[model samples]
Structures are given as C-alpha cells and as structure tokens.
Target: MFPLEHIAIRQAAYYHPEKVVHNDYYLDHFKSRGKDIARFLQVMGREQRYIAAEGENALTMGYQAARKVLSDAGLASEDLDMIVFSSQTPEYTYPTNALLLHHRLRGKSRTITLDSNANCAGMVAAVEQASRYMQSNPHVRYALVVGSDLSSVNCNPEDEITLPNFGDAAAAVILERRAERPGFIDSLYYTDSDDCENIMFPACGLSNIYNPEMTPEQIRISWKPFDGTCVVEPAAADIEEVMRRNGLTLDDIAAFCLSQFSLKNIELICEKLGADMDKFIYVGDEFGYTGTSSPFIALQRGIEQGSIKRGDYIFFWSVGAGWQLPTVLFQY
Candidate 1:
C-alpha cells in the first residue's frame, strides 16, 4: 500500500442522454404485469431516467466523460500514469474498459491500465486506490478515475419492473498530487459478503449459469424483471461506524454524497443519522440508478449546481453488489 501525502481531484464530467420515459407507462404496465414493480419504483422515488439513445456503450460513454476530465484538467493523454475505470458493465468480458479508454486516449502505453467492478462504492474505492498508487509510485504524477455504467441494457423494459428507473451515465475525475494541500482527507471501507444476495442483476455474467435444457432466450427471460430490495440498514450502520472512527459528528460533514439507489433509502439514512437532509446531494431525480457513477456524478453536479461550497467537507458513502460499504471523507 502506498502512503498518500496529498492528492486533489482536478475535475469531473459526465454524459447523460436527454431521452425521457414517462412514469404513466410503467404504472399502467406494472398494474397488469407486476404490481410489485410499480410499488418498488414509487418507493424508489425515481420518476424518469436517462438512457443511451443508440450505439452508446459503457466504453463510449466513459470516453466522452473522460475526455472532458482531460480537457478540464488541461492535461494531455500523455500526462496520465494510470487509468482506473470503475464499472461492472464493461463493453466486453474479454477486454477491460481501461484498455478501451487507453485506445481512445491514442496509445498512452506509459500508463498502467486497470478496472474496478465495485459498482456503488467504486468512486470512493478508486480514489483510495489511486491515492495509494500515487503514494507508492512517487514518479507517477496523475491518475484518471472513471465511474461509468450503462444499466439501461439490463433494464427489463417490457417487464415494467425496473425499466423507468434504470439509466445510463458516466463520470470521470482526475487525481493528482499536491504540495501544500490535497483534496481527500480519510476514507473508510467495509464489506459484508454474506449479504451479497440482497441486490443483483439476477442474470448476467457468471450468474447466468447455463441450464442443460434451457435455451438462451429462456435464460434471458428468466433474468428479466430484475427487482430486489435495496436494503440500507447494514450499510447505514457501517457508515455510522466509519464516522465514529474518524471522530467526527454528522454536523462536521458539509455534504453527503451517497449511492443513489432510491429516494426512500436516502431519507432513511438521513433520518437514522439525524443529519440535515438538505446537505445530501440528489442525482437520482435526473440520472436515476447509475450503478457506479452515483458518487462522482453527485460530486460534479453538486459543485456545478452550487450545492457544495469551497472547503466543504464532503462525506461519501456507497454500498454495492457484494453488499460492500465504503465511506470516504474529502475536502474541496
């Protein structure tokens, strides 16, 4: 592990499509298709979401956002020492998204390419990893952090279960070392592998085990209606423990950037902590359930939209597939 002295988040960017899907359509279909679908969505507090129009994969979306980060940081592709792409949804199972991004970057071979599949806790985890990498490799000057997800493809549109809420988006952040002061303060990570079954894609990747008699189409149908309860209690308790470990109270946190799973869960976490709800950043209203892009998207949007101020102590909390809980503390 590298010891991080100082690191700053240079800039962040994201790509969200403008296409809109109406809630009424889902409501009507769910009434006849699966009532639990409608109820689940309603409680999730997602009215609509953005989806890639066409020919938009995670790699492309990530490229679009990563280019913005490069431009914003005023650094050329040659400056990056490492590219850490965080996403469970890769363009292909063979070549990782990091390699695809490297291609888009026009052959930056000097950079060590890697990918993280931590879903919700990805950004925080990436930040931690990048910081450690920079700390160890003193010669490495910069690292590119990408959190992208195109969840709409897995969304069961006709099933009316999780269609309206699933959206696709990508966010990229540049990490660089600083002399006087840096951005990230302290990060806390926790994982409960036992609760991995609480949330998942149901059918995709290795989970889609081949049945001896079932056809691919039948397997696909079995994977549809990917609906599961996004339990936050265990995650909430973990976050609280992290905060306590840092010897900081909820009031010490200027802003809360949480994994945007649902509106109800957001409220539940805030209420349990008795924290100010207004301090929490909300991206679900526009971006929807972006599996891994939630934190970075919120950070970029929160800063751009004036939701966060300079020198604000931002608290990031994320929970994902492994039921992993990772909390991060930063100042910007």
Candidate 2:
C-alpha cells in the first residue's frame, strides 16, 4: 500500500472553575417554579457541575486547559503550527478568540489560528478539520484544539433548561502527525436542523446587541425544550457507519467518547447498538453539558482514569445545536 499522512492525539486536558453547583442548589429555586428538579436530576444522571467563579469565562478556562495540556506534553507555544478555538460562548466577537489565545501563548508568527462555533459538536469538527488541514500541509506538524464554554453566563436565570443544567468548562487536545500505524482514520457527518430554533444564544440576535430597548432577558440564552431523543438514532447510525467504512468492528474500539449532553441518551444509544456500557466514557454528571468541550472532556478523563491507552482504537461522536452530528474513528 502507498504511504499516507496521519494525525493523532498527543495529549488532552480539561479545566473547570472552582465552584461546584450540585442538584440540591437548584432544588428550592426550580421547585418554586413548579418544576421537578429531583426527577430532572435523576433522569439526566447529573449530580453536580462546575461553575465559573467571579472572574472566569470561556477564554480563561480554555487558556488554563491549553496550558496544562502543553505543559504535560512539554510543548511550548512556538511548537504548535496551528491553534483552533471552538466555542459558542466566545469572549470576543472580533479579533477572533483563537488569535487572542495565540497572542496570550506567544505563538510563533507562522502558526495559523482561527475560531469556530458549531455549537456543541464544535470540538469534534475542529479536530477533524485540523487533522485534514495538517494532513494536506506537510509543514504543519503540531496543532492545538481547545473547546471551552461559559454557558452558565449565557443561560437565562429563570429558565430551567439552561440555568440548572448547563455548566462551564474547557478542554484542550494536542494533535501530532505520525508516519506509522493508525491515527485519524475517517469522519462522518449528518445534519438535522428541524429543531434549529429550540436552543439559541443571543436570543435577540447579534444585530440587536446594542439596541437600547433590548432587555437583559432578551440577550440571554433562549432554550425551548424539545425531545432530545432526536440525537439517539442519528448518533447510533453515524457510529456504525464510521466503523463499517473503516473496516473496524465494535470489538476494535477501546472506548466510546460521546457527547456529554445526556446520560439517558447515551444509555439509549448503547441499548440500540447493543454495545456494552463499560466501553463508554461519560463525565457529564460532574461537568454538566459543556457545549463544544463535552466529548474532549470525556476523552481526557477517560485517559486519565486508564479507560484508554496508547495504540487503542477510539470512537468520538457529538451533536451540535440546530443539530449536526460529527463522528470520528481514531486510534490513540
């Protein structure tokens, strides 16, 4: 066989603010609104989540995580050939969050930097995009992909869907090209935007950000509840397809790093796929739904906990808002 370019994960780390918000914290508040906070927590399988402290946001969280990953890998800013920041809760709309991060890291002038927002599935998309970009450019070797979100700040205070469920966290991964065995294999994507309007940040739209009449409530996240089950079938299909096309089987995968959106959904997908729950890595209960960083957080924690190891096959899957699914089949 002819030789081919390859890219694979080098290291990954995640960061969360110091504060922890448990289900009990939302009990009285959500109960007063006639909502079943207990059932909600039980159904979601969430115990507690990390919340940004007084001075934290996406940028800060992401930077900390990135620094940790780089430190662990013994890589300096100049070592990276590209930097990609993925988030919907970006700290700045202009100047590009990725570029800002690059500036903070004192990245080399030759490094390519950019920001992307594909909602929750962002990091998955970013990694795939970065891998493809690096594969085509022989000059680019190491790349940084960070996914962070301060969703708690964007959430509506009175909204049960956003306020009580969402949390803040950031995850960073270092990808490097290899010449040997397996690395990034192939990716599959499918989109279903029928419920596109259900979840939205900047409810009033960016154009109205400066409008004098726009109230605080209007600028916060707008979360209209929908059947989250929309993700299950598609997720299962995509996972199977990626494995099929790659000539891999369920037995070949060492772990499944799925979106931390809902534990119930993950359980259902496992049931549908007849896959063992032991192979699935989930950290949503403690971290909550961290938007774009969800899967990466799962990946990092999985590795740290010894659920995955070097040269093992890994499957990654996540769903974005307006609903986009990006599935990746990789060898760690």
Candidate 3:
C-alpha cells in the first residue's frame, strides 16, 4: 500500500484569552485570595487559562477557527466536503454546535455536517469519523474537524468547585485523503457510563426542565479530583493497547497530547506507562479546561514550537464526561 502523502494539516488555529477567574485580580477578591484554585491549577501544570469574552460562544469560536484553517489551506468554504464538530459545549444541545458552525460558515457549501458529544475524547472520535468518511468517498477531498468548547460558560458561578477551573477555546484541523503512508494509523475507544455520574454537571438537562424550581444552588456540580481517577487508568490502558497493536511503544511517540484537564493526571498516566512525561504539553494553565479543544490546541502548539514534526509518531488520550476514554496514534 502506498503511504498517505497529501494528509497534511492546514495550520491548526485557535482563539482564546489569557485571563480568567483564577488570575490574581479575580483571586484577590476572595477571602483566601483564590489560592486553593491557583495552587490546584499550578500543580495541574496550568499557568493561566483563557475565557470567552462577552458575546463569544462555542459557535463563534468554532466558526472563527475553522475559517482560519480554511484560509490557511487556501481552500474556499465550497471546497469543504464535510464539517465534523466535536464539543461538550454547544450553542444548544438540540441544534448542536456542528450545525451552528455550518450556518456560520455561511451555509454556502453542501457539506455533510454532524456534531459529536465526546467531550475531551471527542477529537479522537471525530478524526475517526473523518477517516472513514473520506475513505468511503474519495471525492470528499477535504474535511474540517473542529473542537470548540465553552466550558467556562456552564460553570455555575455559585459553585466554587467548577467555577475556577473551567475556561473556553476552539481549534480546527483540516484532514484530507493521502495516497501514501498511513496518516491516521489506529484508534481505541471505550466508556464506562456507570461511573458517568462521578464527574459531571449534574444539572441542566430534561430532568431540570421538569423542575424549574431547582435553582443553581440545588444543581450539584461535582468537581472533586477523584472524579477523574476512574477514567484515567482506563485511558492509560487503552493507550497501551493501541501501542501494542501498532507495534509501537511510548518511546516511538514523538509527543503525547491528552485532555489536559490536570497536570497531575498527565504525570500519573505517563508514570504508569513508563512514558516520557516531558513530552507532554500543558495548555490548561493558560487555556483552562477547554474540553475537546485541548488535544487540538496541543497538536497545533506542538507543531508551531517544533515539538511535533513531519513523520513523527503522535498519540492522543482523552477522557471526560460519560466516563469515556478514546485513544489514537498518528504520524504527521
């Protein structure tokens, strides 16, 4: 089989601000000076996080970044064959962020647009979706895969647990068919919905609709550290499995980009697998927890900084709501 040569990335770009509630200005108002959140964020390997300014939402961010990718590739909106969007934060859960972005892209192209609710693991799954769709219809020369999240918007202001850590951001990657070496090598996806409730925004659903009287205070938001433990171990295990099947190991990986929710989790995962934790990048400190956008942003930043290069093996591991863990291995 010929290698996939044309499967190049079109300069992934993102939009986010560098200030949020965790900063010194915001923290100074708190009785403890937001030290708890600041220290937690520091240990998580996040220095600062970005927040969506007034009027900015998931759709806007996604639309803007996707446009960047399109412009960078010198491809018109009409050239896009499909729009695959992945995000936990959407303009609305019903219309979905993907459809919203499709309209924002001017609806000029008859692209088959679909949205995935994969949270942090959504990017890997979206890549899988694009790969299968492109393989089936080589006519679809280009696909825009977007990861735009507004986690900060959902954080209950009164709920200190989630309020301090959530942030907002968006990223886009343009993928095309390549008739050469492998571009997207392999992937593994798994979920444990039983533990889904462990880490979740337990409010804002149909159930809450029936009970409007349930105020924000009544809404339970569990942001405890252990909330992520269950999925972390499985995520690491899945990464190992993917590596084993591909005849590769951690050493072969040029970089490892995950959800970037916490620096501690990144360290633990690398330690468990005996991987080089130094290769891991952290944007959560500056971008906050951008949900699905984490991995995409990481990949883009890695390439720009010369950390990720052509022909380098890169692995992705992401875990978030729904207790889901998905992994992917690729060479760029």
Candidate 4:
C-alpha cells in the first residue's frame, strides 16, 4: 500500500477539442458495414464525441490543460518541480511528450519531466508516482500530472467496435505538498500481459522498427482492435482486492471515477462490485472514451456537477490497453 499524507491535489482541469462528431456520423459511416448504429449507441450509451482539429495533438491539448490547472493554482511554469505526462497517442516515439510539454509550457530547466505509457490507467499511475515524489523530496513543492490522448487518431474508421468508442481529450492536476492531512490513502496495480493483444496497435511498435521494409501506409492501417468484454472480470477482481486491502466496502466509497470505456461496461462493473450505479460518474455518453483522460475528466465533471465533494472517500479505477489495472482509494 502506497499512502501519502503530505501530498494534496491543488487543482484539476481538462480540455476537449472544438470539433464534434455526432452519432449520426457513425450511423452513416457504418451503414454499409452492417453495423447496427442505433443498437450500438443504446448499448454503449454514447451519443457524440469531440475530435481534435488538424493542428491539435496530445501535447497541445495536455499543455492547455496543464496551463489551466497551474493558472488556477496561481503558479507559473517555473514553480513546478516536475511534470508527468501520460499518453499512448504521443506525437513521436522519441523526444517524450512530457519533455515537449515542458518546453512548450516554458518550464524551468531544472524541472524534471517524463512520460508514462500506462494507457487508460495513466492518470492514476501518474498520481501515484507524483505523490511518491512529493513524499520523498522535501524540496519538491509542486508536480503537474497530465493524462491526454487522441485515441481517434489510432482508431480505424472501418472498424465499428473501435471507431465510435473513442474521443480526444486532455486533463491535468496539480499536486502540492501539505503536511496537514492525508492525501493518497492507498493504491493497487495489477497487470496480465497475456491479454495485452486484446487491445493493441499491431504495427506501431518494435515489429515495425525491426522491419525497415514496413511503410507508413502499413503503419496507418494498423489501428487498434479492442475487446471491451475482456476487461470485465479483471476489473472486478482488481476492485475487490483493492477494497479488501484497504478494509473498505462499496458503501464506504462516496464516489467512483472509472475509465470511460462505455456505460454498459461501467454498469456491469458496478453490478459485479455491488456498488451503487448512481455513485459512479458516467461521462462516456458525452465525451466518448477519452482513453487516459477519462477518469480525470470524470472527476472534474463530477465535482462541477456537485456530485463529489471534499472530505469524501473517492475511488479512482481504470483498466488500460496493456491489461493494466490500477485502483486508488483516497480522500478528497
């Protein structure tokens, strides 16, 4: 159990692109493919999603979100001790997105920056890392944690299962050291690499790197094919373990901010855990599954809608592409 009493979440913010794609767009796109667009929408509980404009990418959205959180906290880029940017849809394989964001945000040279490719679980994993840093380093006053992804760019429009499920977004939060109260209560992470291929981009990794003959066209065609059903059992087990380890029941949690994979999946998980469906924030209908940014965006939206409040015991959970599951229980 990794718990931090000194680190506190100072602020949280998110950014979505201006371009929007309605369910009608998917309905038309999948008509010839024999996909039941109406049934898909009803099952997934998704209506529309925001897509990135021509120039917008992960870094740009993340930078905007980071700036918003920092500005709201009344701090400049120079005041940050570290920046942790998490995403699978990076602009480039090299020159990590975190460093690029640090440069774009005009952070000081001394500020440490790095990236985590934890997929959907990136946000909670980042918070765990940032909280640990603040706990160990007395001089580190503030750290910026960002989870941003443009999953639309990695999706194949022809694949009905993968196409309408994703939307582009970025979310950021500022973590500061405060000696007054507990911040992170405990966090548990579980992964099963055997199921990694269940959700993956087949052409973007070492296989393409080793095979120089692979062209850009091959890479572009290699979109992620996901099996949404594969996550249900693992998520249920992980959530159970987290609760057992922390000695808490479903009723003890005030709010549950989970990955915006789909409303059906969220409801299934809630049923498996015997959790109240009303306590879980549902944002996929409006935002689609924003990949790593889902949980943070949901948390922000819940707070905005007066559903979540301070001193409440909040549970943050997500299952990522690598079959990674990270569950965090904390007091807000």
Candidate 5:
C-alpha cells in the first residue's frame, strides 16, 4: 500500500474561462456535415463548455487558480515549499509551464517547481508526488498542486466525436503537512502504452516536428484523436485492485470523484463496481470535460454541494491520453 501520512489538502480552487459556448452554437456547423447535434450531446452528456479567450492560456488560468487557493488558505506566496503543475496545453514548448508559473506566483527561490504531462490524469499524479515529497521531507510544510489545460484550441471543429467534448479550465490545491491526521491512503497507477494513440495530438510533438515554413494559420490548427473506450477495462481493474489492497469495499467509499469523460461512462463504471451512482459528483454536464482539472473541480464542487464532508472517504480516479489510470483513496 502506498499510504501517506501528515499530508492533507488545506484548500482547493478552480477557474474557468470567461467565454462560454452552448451545444446549440455548433448545431448549424455540424448539421451541414450531416451530423446531429442533439445526438452528439445525448451521447457525450454535455450541454455547455467554457473556452479560453484570445490572450488566456494555461499559464494565466493556472496562476489565477493558484493565487485563489493561496488566498483561501490564508497563506503567502513565499510560504510555498514546492509547486507541481500538470498540463498538456502549455504556452511554450520550452522553459516549462511550471517554472513560468513559479515566476508568476513570485514564489521563493527555494521553492521546487516542475511539470508533469499526464493529460487528464495529471492532477492525481501530481498529488501522489507532492504527498510523497511532503512525507519524506520534514522541512517541507506546504506545496501547491495544479492542473490546467486549454483543450479547445486543439480540437478539430469538423470532428464530430471530439470537438464538442472539450473545455478549458484550471484548478489548484494547497497541501499542508500535519503532525497527525487521517490523510492520504493508498494510490494505484497504470499505463497502457500500446494504446497511446487513442487520445493524442499527432502534429505538435517530436514525432511530427512543427514546420517553420508553414503559415501561422496552418500551425494553429491541430486535432486531438480521442477514443473513450480505451481506458474502461483498465480503469476498472485498477480501482478494484486499490480497493482490495486497502481492504475496503465500494460500500465504504463516501464519494467518487472521477474524470469527466461522459455521463454514460460514469454510469457504466458505477454499475460494474456495484457502487451507488449518487455518490459520484459530475460537473461535465455544465462545465464540459475540463481535461486534467476535471476531478479536482468536482472535488471542490462536492464539498460545496455538501455531498463530501470532513472525515469522509473519497475515492479519486482519472484516465488520460496515454491510457494512464491513477486511483487514490483518502480521508478528509
């Protein structure tokens, strides 16, 4: 078991772009291509989504989320010992978004900063590493874990399956080390590299190098290929294993905060696990799929909605582009 001690989420916050788009906005565009907008929304289970404005990107949204979390926690920028950020849509190919965010926050020189690119599963992966750092280092007291993505930019407007399912958002949480508390419990992570292409942007990375000669418009348009079925079985096995190793059952979990893939997928998983569907918090219908920020946003919403409470058991899980699955159970 990968149990953690003395590490707890002190505060959590999230930020969505100011611009919002409803599914109806895409109706005419899709209908011209012989695609039904109503059927698409019925399958994906999302009605509206937020899109980043012209100037807004991962860094700006992430900074806003981090600043809000720090303010809510009554902490200063200098008090942070580390900052861990996760994103697939960064502002630049170099200098790393984490380092840039550290500068934006005016974090102390001693603050360790780095980035993890796990796509939708990014936040849980960051939490695992941040919790380990806080547990091993007595000097480290507080750390900021962030997950943000501007997925709408990479979506192909003509692609019926992926175009309408994405949204832009950022979320941050402050984790503090305590003397004694029921905090993080075991976590399980799995990756199936064989299916990596199921959800990926093929043109922007090293394999397909960017062409300097191409026009600005040509360089800006790229599509992310996504297949939702790739992770279903693997995620189920991972969740079952985590529960078995922790000696807990589905009945023991007070809430389930999972990636906002779809309402259908969530229902299927709940049925497969024999867990109560009411225990899962879903924000995708209103916020759309916020990439890596999905689960954390749901966590904060659960607390605000009174579905999740202190001393409750939370089972958090996410599956990202690389077919990466990470599941964790903890007590608040």
Candidate 6:
C-alpha cells in the first residue's frame, strides 16, 4: 500500500439571496390564524432568513459562493481538478449541476464534475469524497466543493414547520493536497429511515412530475413533525465514536461545527457529550436552516468569528432528511 497525502479545506465562502425575510414577515400570517409564532421562532433560533427572489436559484447562488472561494484562495477556475456540486432542489436534472458550474467557470476538459443529492448532508459528504479523490489521484490538486439549495421556495408557505425554519443559501469550500498528517481524518455515517416520509420534495414523485394532470400543490416541499429528539442521542454517539476511534477527547477538539438546522439540537448534542457550548459554532439563528449548506455555513462563520483557527482539529457533522447522519473530523 502507498502512503496517502493530506487533504484539507483551504478557503471558504457562502452566499444567500438579497431578499431578507425577517421573523416578522410571517408573524402576521400566523397571527391571523390565532397562532403565535414568537415562541416557536425563539425555540428554533430563527430570527431571519434569506429567501431566493426572482432571478435567484440554486445554480446562481452556488456559483456566487464558488467564485468567491476561488478568488479568495488565489486560484482560478481552470486550476481546479475536480468540482462536486450538491443540491436537492437543483435547477437541472440530466446535465448534472456540477457540469453546468464547470461550463460557467470555463474549466478545462480534464476536470472532474458530478452532482450529489444527500438531502442536508450533501456538503459534508461532498467534502469527504472530494478529499479522498484528491488523495487518490496525484494529478488532482485543487477541488471546489459546493452545496446550495432553494429551501424557502420549496417549503409550503402555510406550513410553519418548514416555512419558518428554512433559508435559501449556498456555501463553497476549497480542498487542496498538503504534505502533512491529520488533514482529512475519519467519518462515521448512520441512517434510520423509519420515518422516511416525514419530509419530501415533489410529493407527487418524479414519474408524475411532468404529468399534465398534476397540480402545483402536488409538487412542492412538504414537512410533517416527527421525533425531533431522534437526532440528539445518535448524533452525540456518532461524534463520540469518531473521536474515540481517533483517540481524541472533547478537550482535544478545537471546535465542533454541527448542522445549523436547530440550535436546540446542537445544545442537546453538546449536553449529551458534556462538551462546552462555546466550542460548538452555530449560525442557525442568523442564517436559518439552509439544508445542504448549513454545516459549511456554520464552519465559515466559525472561521470569521475566530472560534476556529488554522491547524486546529474540527469535527463536522450534519442531519439530513430521512435521518441521515454523517460526521467528519478534519484539521483546518
């Protein structure tokens, strides 16, 4: 067997639509129905969210994030050896969104491009895969991984469960090979699909998506409340197992960049793990639940807030629909 090189995240940047939708935007609607959303909003740690307005979709938002990352990293699009795009609400189906991004960036012919849809766990999975690819292929040096979604537009406006929490956004990360150790470490994945139908997009299914008889109401994101506590115990256990396998304690980890879906969930995970709340970086209050981009968005904010620094060990994880869990340990 050959020795593997280190691959780590280098630069990060995120993007959201210009239209800012505050909590008050939905307050009147819920009020009209004799329901107060103030407590709900506070419980979910949602103060405001960015909604994708006209002319904004997953592709453009993702492109904006990717371009910013490339520029900040002092690298050009042609310098990239691979491009992985993750989005559930992608604007294209056959022509993978990654290919579209490559074309927009005018990438070279040898660049690798593909799309992945793992629900909210998309980016975390994408980063891990891209790192492994770079480590395996010596010619592949720089890779751009992006995760973006149109959460707001997909959520049914009347459903408070989805409408109030989701925000539309995109985040891009730069991964480069380094001659060092502990750059890309181990990952643990767990799936419990008993409640697979709790949340779904295009409820009518793809086969009926283009049927002329199908109405618009049958082809949008739907949300139904499930066991929210199902995330805490397992999430904490997974992170602990990953750290345990790597001989790391809570004190050894510099920061824990968890999903931005719910502050309560992050709190619960921290409490279960006996981890300090300060070590857990959260931006869900400001960014809302950005689906695929939530974890990376939290990571970028951690970098900006000085909560995480270079050469530090950071643990990343996310919870996707169908209760998918993916945890990754990396040196940033």
Among all candidates shown, the one with the greatest lDDT: 2
TM-score of each: 0.88, 0.97, 0.89, 0.91, 0.92, 0.96
* Candidates, ranked, TM-score: 2, 6, 5, 4, 3, 1
lDDT of 3 by residue, 1-332 (tens): 33344454545777775445555633543435433455654656655578888888888888889988888878877777788888766777777677777777765556888888776778767877687667667566678899888777676665544666667888898887777654778788887787565556545554774586877644545554455555668878888899899898777888988888777888888888887777887677777778888887888888888999888888877886767677878887
Check candidate 2 and list the clashing pairs. Answer: none
* Residue 63 lDDT in candidate 1: 93
Worst 10 residues of 6 by lDDT: 1-10
Candidate lDDT scores, in order, read 0.75, 0.89, 0.74, 0.83, 0.82, 0.88
lDDT per residue (tens digit) for residues 124-196 in model 5: 8888778877888877788999999988877766777667888899999888887667677878888778766
Per-candidate RMSD vs. true structure?
A: 3.3, 1.9, 3.0, 3.0, 3.0, 1.7
Q: Which regions of candidate 5 deviate over 4 angstroms?
A: 1-5, 202-227
Write model 6 residue lDDT over 58-118, tens digit each, in one string: 9999999999999999999988989999998999997999999999999999899999999
**Best candidate, TM-score-wise?**
2
| Candidate 4 error regions (>4 Å) | 1-5, 202-217, 221-227
Candidate 2 residue lDDT tens string, 1-332: 21447898989999998899988888878888887778777777788899999889899999999999999999999999999999999999889899999998999999999999999999999999999898888888899999999999788778877787888999999998778756898899999878899877799999998999998889999888888888899889989988888888888889999988888999999998889999999898998889899898999898989989999999889989898999988899
Cα displacement (angstroms), candidate 6, residue 137, comes to 2.0
Residue range 126-212, candidate 1, lDDT tens digits: 877787778668766789988888877665556453466768888898888776464777776676576554345534335544656
Cα deviation in Å at residue 209, candidate 5? 5.0
Tens-digit lDDT track for model 4 on 1-332?
23434787778999999998999989988997877778878788889999999989999999999989998889999998899999878876678888998988999988888898887888888888788777887777889999998878767667787678788999999888776654677787888787566555645665665577865434542545456767777777877887798888877788888988878888899888888899999888888889888998988898899998877778888887767888887777
Clashing pairs in 1: none
Please state the error at residue 121 of candidate 3 in Å: 1.8
